[model samples]
Target chain A: MTGAPQDPADAEACPVAPTLWLRLEADGTYRVGLTTTAARRAGAIVHYRGPVAGRAYAAREPAASLESEKWVEHLALPLPGTVVEVNPLPTADPGLLNRDPEGAGWLCRVLAGPTDGRAAPPSVPTGAPE
Target chain B: MSLEPSDEARPGRLPSWRLLDLGRCAPARAQAFVEAVAVSVGEGRVPNTLVLAQPSAPYLSLGFHQSFHEELDPGFLERRRIPVLRRVEGGGTTYLDPDQWFFQLAYRDEGGGRGGPEDLKRFLRGPVAAARSLGLSAELRAPSDLVVGGRKVSGNAGGDWEGAHLVVGGFLLGADVRAMADALRLPHPALRPLLRGLVAREVTSWEEAVGVRPPWERFRQALASAIATEGRFEARTGAPTPAEEARFLEETLPRHSDPAWRELPPAPRRAGSLVRRLRIAGPHGLLVFRGSGEHLAAIVDGDRLVEAYRVGDGPTDALEELGEDGDGRAAVAELVASTPSFA
Candidate 1:
């Protein structure tokens, strides 16, 4: 019955995007994931294959593949960057992507340059509400 | 990019899409052909395509994400000499035979404008209209299901394959409910009849819906023509390229046939000897529960009881208890309460 925490820190911690949830960490790496809305829309995720950690990708390129009961989608990286780490939890139990998309359900962490100076943002938009 | 009609286009004319009519082939070949088209289309070598095919023999097909061990009884499949393969698109386990007509559409993913969800809705509309044109009151359900009078007639799944967006679905002309029930790994032996009844109640076929079984040729042409008219596509019949066929024989079939691809990792070990694991169709979704002596793990997904706990020490004893009052849910709840709640 209670509302989710409205703290700015928590809000800034995980910003919502059209297709994914983005979290800007202090270490400068961005933790990216398929938003809970997107996850549920795709149905229960039953399998996942993520890009290898340390692999660099161009913006809009596929970084991970997710499969649910009724659909399969490839999540593209929003920015050009090298993947620092990929979450192991969803690989073993893909349902975690639906259960806790912003927490244990994160897909990967990428090290990218600052976004403020960029002329165009990533192909997918960011900053929507979760 | 500005939107404009091509110079080659005449007034009220739309682009033509190729249709591959791969009539009755081995189940593995059918799966392989779809994959080949996805690859070819994604590479921009082939035009946006609609593939129509059916399996010459019966086989079990698993969703891209499903674990074979969890969804199927391998011994039954083996005894029946039914080959099993995983598809690139997502959906639950299904039995495919010559009776069902498979349709797969693959097109280029034009970024922006329409997203995956919207595209699925648009893609399914043509087929739904086609079914309705046959005098069946079919409707499109969310996420891509075609239902008639509240029972499912067609099930669909879609995904992106490299640069192509693909949706694969099928219309059931007829089905073997008993074979389907036997193939799946139900929790208890006594549940087979229940599973058969459940499947019959939940699913429908062309014969069941229309009270007459239309010829395969007639149904195929009707669906193809209807889709062509609805989508503004000119259907051109074709076949897979020789290269695609070679790839299917060499790469696709062998990889899917691997044993490791079908197995699931071992379950987490817990205290007490494992007694039974039951998968029941609950009111909500699939109920799957496993019990090891006194420990039980129960999980419910949607209307089906996907997971459940063990009611008694053995399968026979559990079936007896389930039959006691003819109430499975109460027995499940009692077992659930007796076991420690992990949540």
Candidate 2:
């Protein structure tokens, strides 16, 4: 978890969830991306339905969805916050979602409030998910 | 993105499922009802439930993340009067008929870092157990499948919808491989034969797997029992609460049947792309055609394009630029041009 802001805080898969990777920018905005393991387990990434910018999602509430040939997964941010921006590349180009999930395929930018009812979960271990 | 296993997640089971055995129904009704139950359970208005249903007739359904135009030939369905309903669960396009027995479940998402290979096996344990009871040597396959004697016996999908974890799957009592493949939109003319053959080798039905097709009643009962026991649910057979019923009749049903929902972009449209994506099932991936007033970008967005097949030209029309390869694009273009409000 290099360059992590505080900690990753998604509700669906953690107390120390590996489902999403979070990074903090200098402006207090958080960059969120799906972890590689979650992407691989989803099989082939075919479609992405991300949150509408400006919509507020409670901690763990699904902020986006990733669809594969066999399954569909609703994605949630680790901390409760409002989505400030969403990357449009993955929605148009589904390949990046699988090939560079934590890098170029980052999902959204969220701004978390101090008392958003949920705290950041611990950082994903350096070894990460297989 | 640690894909490693952890023992920290609390072991919790899904709540008891109130079994709603709608004896037989129109395909849309079955889809709508499952959605109703999911919304109710997710919203905490109704108990967690398992639905047993059979469509009275044949129909086509698209998964939530599937673009209707991408996966199917709409005019073909319209001419045949085949109804298409888009379900919330994400998967590939599916063909449903009375010969298949459908089961859907919805429960409170007791979040504990689920959705790994092991979690998929855990979720499908009941179905695997149920299939074996019917005398097929069924086993749970990794990443969402139930196979019997090496052929897939069921199609299942899982996801969070309306705040609840929903699981949907079905047992094929009989399969019409040709119809199943034909119902889909193909990117190239050459793939038709391959399509049917591919489907035949991959899927199996009860009639094909076992010596005889067990009576639907017998199989349905077995499914309910296995699911209840394995899911740790009591299996109370009943109906949705009044609120759930109201939402179904008013909200869910209408939305399922609405053309707007059926034709929605499986994925959100690219920012600034004018017209909706005109997509078709290519041999290797999704072939997408996005055309605005004058510009059209043809790209296969998913897997690499193994081979390029050009759709030379179509009849002169608003969307004819999409080209005609004797597949179905020409027909789709004509349909789109004639319709006053083409997406």
TM-score of chain B of each: 0.79, 0.72
Alpha-carbon shift of residue B312 in model 2 (angstroms): 9.8
TM-score of each: 0.72, 0.68
Candidate 2 lDDT by residue in tens digits, B1-343: 1111242232563444578888688887766577777766766666677888889998888877777786786555876678888777766778889988888877774422244334445667888888889887778655566777657777777776555667788888888777887787754443445456556766788888886887878888988999888777657677767777776887777777677767765554544422323222211122333333233323332333222222322323222233346544453444333322201
Worst 10 residues of 1 chain B by lDDT: B278-287
Question: What do the candidate models score in CA lDDT, each in turn?
Answer: 0.64, 0.64
- Model 1, position B96: C-alpha lDDT score: 78
Model 2, B218: alpha-carbon shift in Å?
1.6
Q: Give me the candidate number with maximum TM-score.
A: 1
Instruction: List the candidate 1 regions with Cα displacement exceeding 4 Å.
Output: A1-63, A75-84, A91-104, A109-130, B1-12, B111-115, B264-286, B291-311, B318-343
What's the DockQ for every one of the candidates? 0.21, 0.23
Candidate 1 structure, TM-score to reference = 0.72
Tens-place lDDT digits, model 2, residues A3-54: 4464433322544335687888778888888877777877677767777687
